[model samples]
Target chain A: MRDAFHDELNALNDRLMQMTNLVRSAISRATTALLDADLQLAESVISQDAEVNRLYAEIETSIYELMATQQPVAVDLRTAITALRMGADLERMGDLAEHVAKIARMRHPVSAIPVEVRDTIVEMGQIAERLVTKTGSCIATRDVDLAKELEDDDDAMDRLHRRLFRVLLSKDWPHGIEPAVDITLIGRYYERYADHAVRVARDVVYLVTGSREFDDSAS
Target chain B: MRDAFHDELNALNDRLMQMTNLVRSAISRATTALLDADLQLAESVISQDAEVNRLYAEIETSIYELMATQQPVAVDLRTAITALRMGADLERMGDLAEHVAKIARMRHPVSAIPVEVRDTIVEMGQIAERLVTKTGSCIATRDVDLAKELEDDDDAMDRLHRRLFRVLLSKDWPHGIEPAVDITLIGRYYERYADHAVRVARDVVYLVTGSREFDDSAS
Candidate 1:
């Protein structure tokens, strides 16, 4: 029974890893769709979100089932609970990616991001991709250090997000209200994507340390 | 032992109710702060969010403890898990309200919503308040019907959100990028707040029905 419980836990971890990969690909593809105005890629990313949601639901149900049957205590209990929270964060990250893709698809032939701020958006996307990749590793290996490092990536994403805001607020910004709204919302999507990644990492920290300190800081 | 478990469950429900009330007030105050440019109210809302977070943590810890010790099954188990998810959604709703308040504080001495879109924002805020109020009742009574009605409020919010965009994109948009961005984000904050309420209501639906259909629809 103990071995079976451990196997279920391992399966849960694998499912979470799969979710992280799906979210990573969604954000990456969504960014490409946004920058290149590729409706096909955008649609693909949007539709693929169902898969991420499915994985999230499956992992969440499994966690609950594990808890109900195994009645894990101490670290094992913490692991199951934290896995549920991390699944939620990852699912939200995927939703953010889908939001970006929807914006890209809505704009169709025209890029959602104006050319002047495109580079910053690209940089934010890169940071988000890197953060999720590291977060996936952190979850799989329970690497507290790697989880801690995601904060730095999140900081980089924040700086890029601020840069996008500065450009929009600049007197020289000529894109007017439509593109400005698009850029602001799109920037927010990327910013929130990184935030969720950081949140997942923080959940990993909590699972390891059993401390609410990291979770508190993320808020 | 069963009585003790019931007492604990009641305490969990009370904490959730308290959280709902706190989040409701936060959104109300945040909306006022944004519309009136009241920095004091915005600061009050922002600072009060800590209480909401504390309640969230307390409720979450209690739920986990209940599950671990009680080993609740069937309806009881579903209730416990659903409470956890509902607490999370309510906490996020509080955070969204805080985000709105922060925007209000950041834009102090100036209204965030331009005059053209001010009424629409006001309407959105009202819809959010109503939905949350119903959501609170739904949580307390397990009123699946009331929970289902939140979707209508969400639809109303979506329409208002779309209206804000139309105003921003209109040729008559007098305000430049700065105010436009502010209005856009503020609209989103309210929209997301309502979405979280609907999510909480949906959790209640799932707890009662043991079905994932509504949950899938919301996502």
Candidate 2:
């Protein structure tokens, strides 16, 4: 039974890795669409959201079944619970990507953002992608050190986020209020993505450390 | 042990209800300050945030201890887990109120938003406060039906949010970018508050139904 549970756990992690990779691609494609005003990629992200949502449901059911049937205790319990929380985080990350894609579609033929804003958006995408990648890797290896590094990465994202806002508020901003709104919402989406990534990392840490070492303080 | 666990659970719920009330009042005061340009109220909300954070930590530690000691299963496990998640949702709600309050301070002698925008903000506040109140009641009584009603209230908040954005985007808007940024962030804070309320309601539904229902489809 324990060996079977181990296999089930590995299967769960595999599903999570797949979801993380898909969400990363969605984020990348969504950013590309936003930066280039590519309607096709934007539409693709939106259409792909259903698959992400379905995966979320499937993972939720599987995790619950594992818990119920295995009655897992100790490390096994932690692993199952972490998987459940990570699934939610990944799903929300997907939702954030979908949101960015929707914004991309809204921009359509004419870009609402200035070139500077586009640059910030792309950097935000890269940072978010890195966080998501780290989260997936940490889950695969149960690397607490990697999880801690992801926590630090979020601090840098926070600094960049603040800088992005400062640029928005600068006196020389071009294209007026619409760009400001776009930039603000875009910053929020990236910040949220980073947040969920941090959450996944923290769950990894908790699974290994057996301590609630980080919480709101990490944010 | 089970009886003691229930007592501790009740105490935790009581603390949570108190926090919810504080957050609800904070949101109300913050919104009032926003509309009335009352800087003092915003300042008070910001200062009071530490208390909320402290209570959150205390509740979290209590939940952790319970889980570590009791090794609770099934309904007891769900209840404790739900309490911890509820504390988190409430803490974020407090933080949102703090953000709104900060916005109030940012616009000290608050920026003169148009009457239409002010009305929408006021309405948004009312909805947020009601959701807080109803969700708190749901927690205290374990009333799933009332929790469902709060979910409906969240839908109302969404509608108001969309309407506010539409008004902001309307061609005749006279305001430039600053008010636009403020409105955009304020909308996000309210939207997040609604999201948390919906989360609390979903947890209640799960407790009542003992079923894993995903928010993606229901919402």
Candidate 3:
């Protein structure tokens, strides 16, 4: 029974990793589509979202079954629960990618946003992808150190987001208010993507250390 | 044993409700602080955040104790897990309120943000407060219908967000990019607050229905 449980758990992790890869690619393509005005690429991101959604549904069902049948205890329970949360994060990332794609379709061509802003957003997207990749590794290997590194990487993304806004609010901002607003929203999406990645990293840390490190505040 | 287990679960729910009420007040006060640019009110929101954080830490510790001691199965485990998730959401809502307080400090005594825009944000804040309040009631009573209603309320907030963006992006946008960015980020904070409330509601739905109404792909 223990061996069977391990095998099933591995299978579940494999599915989560696959979903993570899809989310990462969707984000990448969506960013590229936004920069290049590739409506086809944007549409593809939109189309692929259903797959991510379907995978999440399947993963949730599998998780529920695993919990019911295997009755995971202690660390195994944490692992399963973390995967469930990670699945949710990945699915939401997919949704953000879809939103980016939809925006790309809406704007199309010459782009209301400036190239410099788009470049910064693309850079933020790369950072978000790295965060997701590190998080996936942390889960698959149960590496607490790798997860901690993702947390630090999130700081970098946060800095980029601040910089993005600074640029949006600069006097020389060329594309006017619409583009500034668009880029700022895009920056927020990237920032939120990184935030969710850090959340998954925190869960991974908790899974391995059995200690959650969130900051405490008084009510 | 079962009776004691149920009692403890109820206690946990009661504490979560308390945290929800605290978060609701934080948002409301944060809104007042923003509208009035009252340093006293902003300081209050900032000071009150520690309380929310402490409550979250306490609840998390209590949850760990319950899991370690009770070894709850199935639905009971789900309840503990949902509590953990909801605690995180409330903590985030508090953080967002604090963010608004910071905004108040940065743009005090007369925000460049237009009166109309400020009113729209205040409305969004009110909606977020209602979402949390309804969420508290739904979780305490396990009212799935009330949970669904909160989901509908999120849809209304989304509409408000879109309208806010439309006005900011219109040809006659007067406050320039800085105020527009401020408005967008604040809208995002409220939107995310609503999103987490919907997440808590979905958890309630899952707890009661054994099937999730909203997954990660949900808006």
Number of the top DockQ candidate: 1
DockQ for candidate 3: 0.48
Alpha-carbon shift of residue B75 in model 3 (angstroms): 2.6
Give the residue spans of candidate 3 off by over 4 A. Answer: A214-219, B213-217
Q: What's the residue-level lDDT of A5 in candidate 2?
A: 94
TM-score (C-alpha, index-matched) for candidate 1: 0.97
lDDT of 2 at A146: 90
Q: On TM-score, who's better, 2 or 3? A: 3
**Off by more than 4 A, model 1:** A217-219, B217-219
The most accurate candidate by lDDT is 1
Q: Which regions of candidate 2 deviate over 4 angstroms?
A: A212-219, B111-114, B212-219
lDDT tens digits by residue: candidate 3, B47-99? 89888888888887787667666667788877887788788778888898888
Ranking under TM-score, best-scoring first? Answer: 1, 3, 2
Would you list the clashing residue pairs of candidate 3? A217-B50, A217-B54, A218-B50, A218-B51, A218-B52, A219-B50, A219-B51, A219-B52
Q: Worst 10-residue stretch by lDDT in candidate 2 chain A?
A: A210-219
Scanning candidate 2 chain B in windows of ten residues, the lowest lDDT window is: B210-219
DockQ of each: 0.64, 0.47, 0.48
Q: What Cα-based lDDT does every candidate model obtain?
A: 0.88, 0.83, 0.80
Ranking by lDDT: 1, 2, 3
**Model 3: how far residue B218 lies from native, Å:** 3.9
* Residue pairs with clashing backbones, model 2: none
